[model samples]
Target chain A: MRLQDQLLFNLRSLSRQRFRTLMQLIAMAIGVFSVVLLTGLGEGGRQFVMAEFSVLGKDILIILPGRKETSGGMPPLTGGTRDITLQDAQALSRLRNVDGIAPLVVGKAEVNFSGRSKESLIIGANPEFFIMRHLRIQQGQGLLQIEIDQARPVCVIGPELKKELFAAQPALGKWLKMAGSRCRIVGILANSGTGLGFDMNNALIIPVASSMQLFDTQGLFRVMIDVHSLAGMNKLSKEVERVMQERHEGELDVTVITPASLLSAFDDILAVLTVAISAIGGISLFVAGVLIMNMTLISVSQRTAEIGLLKALGASSRQVRILFVSEALILCLAGAVLGILSAEVLLWLARQQFSDLLFIAPWWASALALIVALTCGLVFAWLPARRAANLPPVEALR
Target chain B: MIQVNQVNKTFQLGDQPVHALNNIQLKISPGEYLSIMGPSGSGKSTLLNMLGLLDIPDDGEYWLQGCDGLALDTVPMDEEVRARYRRDHIGFVFQSYHLIPRLTAAENIELPLVLAGIPPDERKERLQPIIQRLGLEQRAGHLPNQLSGGQRQRVAIGRATIMRPKLLLADEPTGNLDSHSGAEVIELLEELNNDGITLIIVTHDMDLGDRAKRKIRMVDGEIVLDKSREQEPS
Candidate 1:
């Protein structure tokens, strides 16, 4: 038979059993839908986490005081009682791989500007801290080196803090009181949005010296280091560890986190998550495959006489097999198309609701879905097609 | 031409083996119209099925046009080859008519041609004449359920002979039809036989057997009587 005529005949045969065909298509759609949506969400979550980490300076490294033994466990902050000193920050800055260092003292405090008072995190660091942490100054001037050297009582307010403290009023040059100590706001930082629901722009920045004096946090510090490149991060981390070990005589504790290491660790967690999700979703496809196999087997049994007639009339076993597989493939293709469209709609709705976060369907994802659908079709349709093809015409006809 | 020599066929129904055909021997020439008549389970249908290449005997040899029927081994023929042979060399007229219910008369007639891999143009070319000759030109568009028994039988005949096979096997071709429709189907088969096609019919109707030039009677899987007209047509 002509290829076109064969296809038309197969299609007509499927149409004759519309309800069964529709059920198979629906099963395939559900399979593909689960795969697409779950993978999309996993990918979207990965991108969101990456974006949040990017705001902390891609080349930056964080060093805490202590370490956790197990992988992925949170490391304890070292020197919880004795904080990192500015001298240590300066000493780390002198390292070859280290680009810059910012020693910070963070504490929760209530601040008042004009008539408004709000609780905010206060980070004390020098002017270079802005560049080290990817902070952008929106108004006035940032804390200067001279101000840090002189221990000036000046601070920079994040955009969220500015809105809470000043509302419509000017925030720059305004006086804000923290712990009953008045400090001049030198600049208002641009909004940095939220990272995993924590608003990064709801913090206050001040000179490290002034913070130590105001919060009575002497000799204690949290130091952030910006590295020159990711390639030498491991070696640099070891070098810093050695230096800190030697400098403290093994008594001073430190925890170091480079962006590359953090990313690799995060990727490890994501890999596990992706596998778990895919395995769960894969079960759905497996179930759908079983459904297809069951339906095809039943179709073979029900259409035994028709198959016998076709065989008697000159259809090859190969042709019979192709006809049934073609039916399954058509069903899967239809379901895949519908499933993809539904997934797109679902992702679009998610994007609409969570406008700040990004959810994108990469080209590779679409290609993967297509490949998966075709594979599922073939795998699921094999046994029944074989059974139909191997039937003896004489016996089948009788 | 067909030849049969000591053919035996047995069916294993659970524990006991039932002999459906036993030591059967028969011969038929081209253009011969033969009728096989017997009571139920008399092996008439079994003989017809063996002759149609739909079954193979467990013993003995049968031949069609010098091709061995016993050792006629082609590895049980692939579906394509069997279908091709069925389309190009053998035609079947079943008691039930067995028309594909969903297809129109013309489409059903075109089925064998389709299976034969005939091009649409050639199929149409062959179909138009046969349909016109069968006086089914007007009913070509009607489905089997929409047609009368006679019209449906005509459509079935058109489908059976569309490829112009050499042998025609009819198994109770008129069993489900009225006498008038039955007579019409018999006439159609006779007309095709006149056109030089070998015909083998199985029927319990003695009157149908009498109309054939040769009649073979079977009982209990063995032929009890074989007779042919002494006066051959000139």
Candidate 2:
């Protein structure tokens, strides 16, 4: 028979019961839709995290005070240890190819201006802090590059702080009392809405020396190091560790997190999540295949007499088999198309909610769904088609 | 022309092996009208099914003349070849009309031509005359359910002949019809027989059996009598 006529015949056979066909289409379409949507959400989550990390800093290292070793449950970490100090940070800065060092000392302080008081996190760092964090000054200026011992009284107040204290007035160069100490707001930091635990829009940024005096401590919270080239990063990190070890009397008391290891750990986690979701989606497709098999079986039994009629009309066993199999294949194709289109609509809706994250189903996800759906249709439809082909024409007619 | 030699068939009915067709031997020349009459389970329809190649005989040699000038054996033929033979040669009409309820009368008639892979334009061209001759032109687009019993059988006959098979087998074609439509269907079959198509009808109605030029009576699974009209010119 010609391919076109045979297809039309098969289609007519399926359409004989419109509700059954529609139900079958829905079952298959949902199977495909879940696969595409789940994979898209999982992959989108990974991309979002990677984008956040890249925003934090690409070629940089974070040096925390205590050694967080993976093998040990706990370390001798707290209580008057030689915390990552400003001297240690300066020693690392002297190493070759080392460009930027921003030593952070975190503490909370209450600031008062014009009788409006609010407590906010205080970050103590040098001018390189702004460059490493990709922060641009929207107002007058940032912290000046001064000696660690100078204790400059100039502080950079964030926009929210300025709004609270100054309230639509010019706040730059105004003196505010922070923790009973007078400090001039040299610049107003712009609002950067990144929520990676360091929201600068509501922070008080001052010089490292001034913060040390205000808090009456010499220890540092962490040191951020930004380098220019990716090459020689291993050597640079090793040199940094060695310098810290020597300064701490041959004790490796600090943990240095290389950018590659940090990002790679996130990558491994997200990749596992992606695979897990895809496998679950695969299981759904399997269930849809089972449903298709059952529907075909029912269809075969229902149309036994019709099948016999076709055989009597001169269709061969192979022709009958092809007709049923192709019927299932057409169903899967339509389901795949419906699933993909619905997924696009869902992803679009999600994008509107979380504009920062990309909500896209990958091309491989679509291609694999199509291939798996088609294969599932074929494999599941085989037995029923064979049963229909092997039915005794004479008895079936009866 | 058609020839059958010692054709036999048995069915496993519960614990009993029922002989549906026993040593059936018959010959039919082209353009002949034959009828077989018997009670239920007497193998009259079984014989018809065997001749239509819908059932395979246990051990028999049946030969059918073909378009390629080859006398194809129906018993030992391969599955595909046998199916092709049926497609290119034989057609069947059943008691219930077997009109493929989903298709319209026109599509039912066009089915065999479609199965034979005749292209659309040619299928249409060949289908018009059969639709006209079946007197189904007014209701050709109607589904089997909407068509009357007479019209449905006419559509079935149109489907049977659209492929222009050399042999047409009808099993109780008038069983579901009233007297008016029954006589109309019987007359249509007779007219086709007169137009040089070989016709075989299996029925329970003896009156219908008397209209054929030759008649056979079956008891159990064997043919007991064969009679031909004395005035008929073969």
Candidate 3:
């Protein structure tokens, strides 16, 4: 028979059992939808996190204190003191590979504005902090070098804090009480939103000199260094460790983390999460496959006599096999189309509701969903098709 | 033409062997109308099935048109070849009619031609004359359920002869029909036999057997009597 005729015959036969065909299609669609939506969510979340890190200039590296060993066990914050100083930042800035350095001193404090009090974090850094972290000033001028030199009581407010304190009013140049000390808001940083459950835009930034005075935290520091290129992160990290080890006689207790390293660790965690989520979602596809197989088995039983007649009339085993498999593929393709359309609609609705907090599905995700649907079709239809093909014509007829 | 020599067929059912056909020998020539008559459990149907190539005898040397029937004995024929044989050499009219319910009369008639890889144009070309000859032109688009008993049998005949098979095997082809419809089917088969096609019919009706040129009586898996009318030389 011509290929078209075979396809037409199969299609016509499927149309005869519309309800069963529809059920198979629906099962396939459900399988594709679950897998696609779950994987898309995971992928979108990863992209969102990566975008958040990207906001912190690609060349930047973070250094934090390592957990120290104590008498009984390891303590949360009992590390050998690194005591990173202004001298360390100054020296790092002079390195050929180092573009700039900003020593940060952060602490929690209460801010009062017109009798409205809110607890927020206060960050201490210099003017170069803005460029090193890629922070943009939304409403006012950023902190200047002269302000840091003169120990100016100036600060930059995060977007959320600006909303809480000013509420539609301009926040720049306004005086607010921070930890019982008055500080003028020099700049309102643009909204960077939240990442990893922390609101990046809800913090206050002030000059290191002012923070040191207000918190009585002199000579204590947490430094952030920006390198000229990411290609030198490993070399620069080793060089910084060597320099610090020599300067402090190998006594400095600090941890350095490069964004690439952080990304690799994050990817490993994401890989595990993706696999776990996919496995959970894959169960639904397995169920859908079972449904397909069940439907096909029923179809084979129902068409047993017809199969015998066809075989008697000259239908080969392979043709019968192809017919059933093609039917399954058709059902799967239909389900996949509906699943993808539904997933896109769901993702769109979620994007509308969550805005940028949730990520949108990429094109490759849609393609993967289609591929997954086709695979489900073939895998699910194989056994049933074989069963139909191998059935003895006389026995089937009887 | 067909030939058979000492054919034996047995079936094993749970350690009990039942002989379906035993030491059967028969011959039929082109343009011959023959009938095998017997009661239930006799070997008439088994002989017909073997002749139709739908079954194989456990031991036999059967020949069709000088071809080695035993060569086709063990190996199951592929669909294309079986379809070609069924389309071009054999046509079967079952007791149930066995019309595909979803297909219209014309579509059913076109099936054998379609299976034979005939193009749509040729299918239409071959279908028109047969349908017209069977007086089923008006019922071409009607489904099997829509057609009367006689009309359905006529459509079945059209389907059988669409590919111009050399042999037509009718297994109680009129068992489900009224006497009038049964007579009409017998006439159609006789008319096709007149056109140089070989026809073998199996029936419990002795009157149907008496109408054929040759009659073979089978009992207990063996041929009991074989006779030919004086008008046909055999």
Candidate 4:
């Protein structure tokens, strides 16, 4: 038969049995839907992490006292480690590629401000810390260079800390007693929301010298260095490690983490995750293929006489087989179209609800879903289509 | 013209071999109107199936017009070649109507031309006269279930003739029809025969069998009698 006529005939045959057609459509749609949803989620996670890391600064490198063999989770402490200190930060700042350096000393301290006491985290850093980390001052100016150099008792409070200790009353220029030392609030930081497990709006940033005296420790928590460019990152990091090794009498105990390396590591893990999820979705699609095969077999048996009629009308066996296969293809194509549209709607709804989580079903995901579904339908339809084509016209007519 | 000699077909029924067509021999010219009259399992249908190239005999020497000497050999014909030959030369009608239930009468009639991959407009052009001759124009849009037995048979005939084949085979064309419808179908077959097309009908009805110009009677897979009436001047 003409290709168009054969296709039309198959479509009409399917439409004649609405319930069976609908069931097959739903089965195939569910298969494609799961694939799209899972893949979209994986993509969303990757995008979300990348976005979060970008906000933390891409040109920045973090130097911790312990060496971590693995890239993710908590870093493990290695034997014979030199302590990361403010002096090490000062030496790293002399490098040409190093634009800024911050010596961080994180500690929980009780703050008594205007007779209001609240326990909050303290972030100790130099004057360049706010600029390197993208922390903006909403009110008053950040710590002055003279204050940071002279160990002045001045601090910049995060928005949450301001809200807790001052409660809408102007906290800038106000004095707050922290760690048995009183300090003037030099600035109130803008409300940058929490991400990557770090709540920037919940801590108080103070000069590194005062923090060292208040926390009663010489070893710094971690050192953050902002490099000029990607090419300069590795050179500057090696220089910092060299300076630290020389100062610690040749103990190579610090781990230098470039954001690019960390980002690529995350990319690798999430990529594998995406493929693993797609594989699970593939298994579901395979089950749906089995269901399609069963349905096609039933349809072929039921349409034996029609198959015979076509053959008697001079249809070759290949034509008969194509007619049946076309029925499966049309059904799967419809299901795939429906599935992609539904996934888009679900993505839209999720974007509305979460707003921050970047959930997107990429074009390739839709294309792959369609290709997979069509291949499954055609492959699964082969046996049943062959069965129909092999029906002897004489026996089938009887 | 058609020729058959020593054609044999066997079937296996639970380890029992049944000879469905036993050393059959027949010859037919173009435009001949023949009827095969037999009871059930008498091999009439089997012979028709062989003639239609729907089945291959276990041993046979059969030939049709334009075929080579090998066409008369007992060797099996290639399936693709047989299918192509059937498409170019033969049409079939069945007792059950066997109409695709979902297709309209017009679509049913258009099937053969469609299978031949004729363009839609040309298929319609080729179909128009056959539909008109079969008196199916009014019922052309109706499905098989929506038509009467006579109407369904007319559509089947239109389908059978739309391809304009040299031979037409009908298996019990009126077996499920009323006498009026049966008579109408037979008249249609005879009319096609009068137009220089070969016609073969398989039936158990003696009345229908006797109406054909040539008649063959079969019993137990063997032909018992073969006879033809002398032609009357037009």
Say which candidate scores most in lDDT.
Answer: 2
Candidate 4 C-alpha lDDT tens digits along B54-161: 777888788876333233432366665666677777889888888888889999888878788889989878888888899887888999999999999889888888
Off by over 4 Å in 1: A70-82, A146-152, A195-198, A213-221, A228-235, B66-80, B231-234
lDDT of 4 at A30: 87
Candidate 4: tens digits of C-alpha lDDT, residues A1-398? 66787778778888999999999999889888888888888889889988887776888988998665565765445645567776677778888888777788888899897678988888888777788778888999887785433477889988998888878687878899987798998888898876555678988888888888898888888888888887887888888778878987886678888878888999999999998988888788878888999999888888888887777777888888888898999999998898888988898898898888989977787888899999989998988899778877778766
Report the CA-based lDDT of candidate 4 relative to the real structure: 0.84
Question: Quick one: ranking by lDDT, best first?
Answer: 2, 4, 1, 3
lDDT per model, in order? 0.79, 0.87, 0.78, 0.84
Q: Using DockQ, give the best candidate's number.
A: 2
Which tens-of-lDDT digit does each residue in A72-186 have in candidate 3? 9654465347576656666666767887778787778899999998899888888788887767888887877753324677888899998998899887778999777898888
Better model by lDDT, 3 or 4?
Answer: 4
Every prediction's TM-score for the first chain? 0.88, 0.92, 0.86, 0.92
Error of 4 at A229 (Å): 4.8
How does chain B score by TM in each prediction?
Answer: 0.92, 0.96, 0.91, 0.93
Cand. 2 TM to true fold:
0.94
| Predicted structure with the largest TM-score when compared to the true one | 2
Better of 1 and 3 by TM-score: 1
Q: In angstroms, what RMSD does candidate 2 have relative to the true structure?
A: 2.6
Worst 10 residues of 2 chain B by lDDT: B225-234
What is the TM-score of each predicted model, taking all chains together?
0.91, 0.94, 0.89, 0.91
Q: For all the models shown, what interface RMSD does each have? A: 1.9, 1.2, 2.3, 1.4
Expressed as tens digits, the lDDT of each residue in A1-398 for candidate 2 is 89999899979977988887888788888888988999999999999888767766668888888777687565555663578788898899898878888998889999888889989879888899988887778898999988876698899988888898888999988898988798898988888755446778889899998999999998888888887687867888888889999999998888888767888899999999998998898889889889999998999888888888888888888988998899999998998889889988999999999998898988898889889899988988889899888776787788
The clash count of every prediction, one per candidate, is: 7, 0, 0, 0
